[model samples]
Each structure stands twice: as C-alpha cells, then as structure tokens.
Target: MPSQPPIPPLLSPYLSTAPSASLTLLTSTLGATSNWLILRFICAALKNTSSEDGSTKGDNEATTVVLVSWLRDATFWKDGGRKLGINFQKVHIIDALTTGLGIGASSLADVETEILKAITTAKPTTRVEGEERVLLVLDGLDFLLAATSCSTLETLDLVGELREHVYTTLLTSAADLPLTQSPTTPLEISHTALIMTMVHQARLVMSAKSLDTGVARDVSGVLRICKGAGAGDKAQEGEGELEEREFLYFVGADGGVRVFERGA
Candidate 1:
C-alpha cells in the first residue's frame, strides 16, 4: 500500500505529546460531523514510530487505539480505518449507544461505570518494555450527554473522572531504561526523556463545528485545540497558548480533512 499522507503540519503539534492517555472534549454543532478528524488523528498516532523523521526505525511497534463510540458501530470504523491505510486490528471499537436496539443503560451512573471500565482495561501496563502507546478516542460526548439523562453538572463530573483515568498512565516503559540504552530522536526522547523532562504531560483536545451560515457544498467548519493539559506553560513562551488557537477546515471529495487558519 502507498504511504499514508502526512498530517497537515498545522495539526502535528497536537498529537506529538509524551505517551499518556488524555481527554479531548470535541464539541460540534448538531449536524456537523467530527468523525473524519478523529480518524485522521488515529492515523497520525499509529504512524508515529521512534523516528522523528516519520520513518520506521528500531522496532516499529504499532500504537493501540481504543475507540469508545456512542454514535457508530464497529463496521463504520473498520471501513474508515481501511480508507486511511490504518490497520483495522490496531483500532478497537466499543459500542456504547444501544437505544436504537431497545436496550439502554438503566442509569447515568451505570453508563459512567461502563465507560470507565473500558478505558481502564484499554490502558497498557508498564510491566513490559517496548510496549506501544495507547490512544483512547471518545467519539461522541454529545450523544452521551443526551442519552444519560443526567444533569449538566453530573455529566461534567463524569468527564472529569474519565479524564483523570485516561491521562495518568506511563507515557512509555522506555522511561525506565538506563541512559546508555536511551533512544535519541525527538519522538523517542519525548517518551524516554529523564525524569525532570517527564514532568510535563500534554494531550490534544480538538473540537469541530459547522459554520452558522454556509452552503452545503462549501462545508465550512471550525476546528480548535480546546486545551492540552500540560501544554499551557510551554505554549505561553512561544506559541501563545493552545486554547487561543483556532482553524477552519472542511471535508473534501476524497474524504480527506484539510485545515486552514480561520482568518488567514
């Protein structure tokens, strides 16, 4: 198969964080779709190896991506993953929405428990070395907000709990290795850097929404980094801050996601 296209440079910074689970809140208009963006992110994460130049060096361990989706089924992701040239096996899909089948969660707490269990089990333990990074993709928070019948505060609390669980794991087992055995590339260093360098933890949170006024073919939409947990201080020194940035992107005829600065 041909090599997958590189993610647009504008979006690369979001996914280049040290290996750790993180929560990204994706808020979009009722009809606008963010599935393509999620798929693109998965492709980018899986394609990242120890090589900073985007080449395969050393052992090319495939990243494990567990997608807990409340909006779609396994087949939907399997097809999308194939189109992106990503190994479908690396993408695990869990179905959390069951209203259409007439069987739904009995309570909001039950739903929260199920989600937490799925994420906790998906996290890789540090007992083994050279384990690939894991990326947890929660596809539809809006669906959960609606289906659970929970108050806004209650739902937000659940999100907070999920975030804590997802973002606190070992970035990479390589961090435990001796200096003589450390890898040198930026990507490798980010994972296996010294304990001092490991203090900061960053993760990408992207949100997409449709333009209030736009023709169907135009497909105008907004994309922005909600916030990456440990990125604020680092970003302030140079890139301003992640939360202050936003972009305009659209879906193309070929199913590719193209992004452009909102006002540039």
Candidate 2:
C-alpha cells in the first residue's frame, strides 16, 4: 500500500470536510446552483406524470425529496448549502469522512430506507406511472477510501452489498430507473424512466457509479439499460444528457492502496 499524497488545498472546495467535533459551515459559500437544478427537476418530475400529454398538477402536495450527500469535501457542502434552496426544509450534510466510513456498513441501507420512507410518506395521491424516484447523491468517494481502513477486497464487498440492496429495492417497488447501465442494451431497460427522470430532475446527484473496475461494468450496464429504456433516443432529441462517472478506490488487484485519478 502507498501513502495518500496530501490532497491539494485548492481542491478543498470539492472534497468533503475533515473530521471535527463541529464544522465551521458557511452556507453562503457552497455551490447552490447544482443543488437547485436538482431540486427543480425533482419538482418537475413529481408535477408532470405524463410523458405524452406533458400534463402536470400543482405543487400543493409536493414534498421535499430528502437529499443525502456523502462526502468529506467542503466544496460539496458549500455548493449544496448555497444551492439546496427553499424547496427543502432541512438538509443533512455529514461533514466528517471518518464518521461516514465508520458507519459505512449500515449507512447506505439507512439512507436508502430514509429516502423511501420520505417518498412513501409524501404519497402524491396519483398513480406515479413512468417513474417515482428518490435521488441519492454521493460525492467525494475518494474520501471514503481515505477513511476506510479495510482491505480493498473488503471495501469492494461492502460496496457490492450496498449496490445489491439498492437495486433490489428499486426493482421490487418498480421505483426509478437504473441509469448507469449502457444505453444500448435491451435487457437493461425497465420501467425505471421516472426514476431516472426524477434523478435527472434532481440534478444528477446519485453516485451509484463507483469507480472500481466493477464500476466500468456497472456503467456499461446502466448505459445499456438507459439506452434500452429509450433514454438515449430521448437524450438525443434534446430531452436530456448523461453525466455519470465510474467508481474507483485506492486499491489494486492485490488489495494494496494507491492514489490514482481517472484521466490522469
């Protein structure tokens, strides 16, 4: 294993916050634009239930879809703080990377459950046909690598567990599309467009695409799924664009830690 180089201080705006009893949070400094775009999308998805007629209802029953961000990056928080907007009553930003990884085993499940509960509680009083999605945005997984002491294999196992749980849950409830799959494959398509649409509406916040080698596989799969779901066609017709990343960690084939970034 190799030591992690000091993360450039200039990049602090993008990384998660360091460990602390309390953080000096500056909401005004955060990047609110991305967060606002996401919020608006969620609102739009909920408001408009029809893809053909493009009809929508009022925002009277609209509830804030909980935004769960996992990152130790101050920039992510800052951006979120500034952009989360008035659509949400509360924003729970966990600043400590160490605490997030320490609780990593259960954190994914807990977050997923909380989002589902929030959505269920909202109950939009109409059949949510194409998609009814809850977006889970994760930033700064690089920090997760820094925080986790486990071997690379162990980390992969943990991540796999989280992925399985989420995919299974979404499939069972027919909620949301799994967008990371390749957009060209037919087998990957499902009735998850509303989920993908809502996620897009939420400004592309879910980090389901971790950059492990498996991440490539996942991305390929999601592309296939989304393409199969007609997302590719839709996107081409000026409907949307795909902005997903592959997951990566600081480990190798032999479970050794190393610092590397994509396109480097």
Question: For all the candidates, what are their Cα RMSDs to the real structure?
Answer: 13.6, 16.8
Q: Which 10-residue window in model 2 sums to the lowest lDDT?
A: 20-29
Error of 1 at 83 (Å): 1.1
TM-score leader:
1
> lDDT per prediction?
0.54, 0.30
Q: Which number leads on lDDT?
A: 1
Location of the lowest summed lDDT over 10 successive residues in candidate 1 = 171-180
Candidate 2 on 1-264: residue-level lDDT in tens?
Answer: 343222212222212211111111111012111232233233333333332332333332322233334443445444443332223332233344434534557554454455455445543333655233332233333233334433334433433343332211111111222322343332223212323432332211322122224434212111001212323334444434333333222322322222223443
lDDT of 1 by residue, 1-264 (tens): 223354655766654443444444344444556777677667766675544544323322436666767677877777776777776656666775543221263566765677666665655555565453567666554344444444445645555566565542222111223321465754333333322232233344455666657654545577766554555545544534344468887676566666778556
Q: Relative to the unseen true structure, what is the Cα RMSD of model 1?
A: 13.6
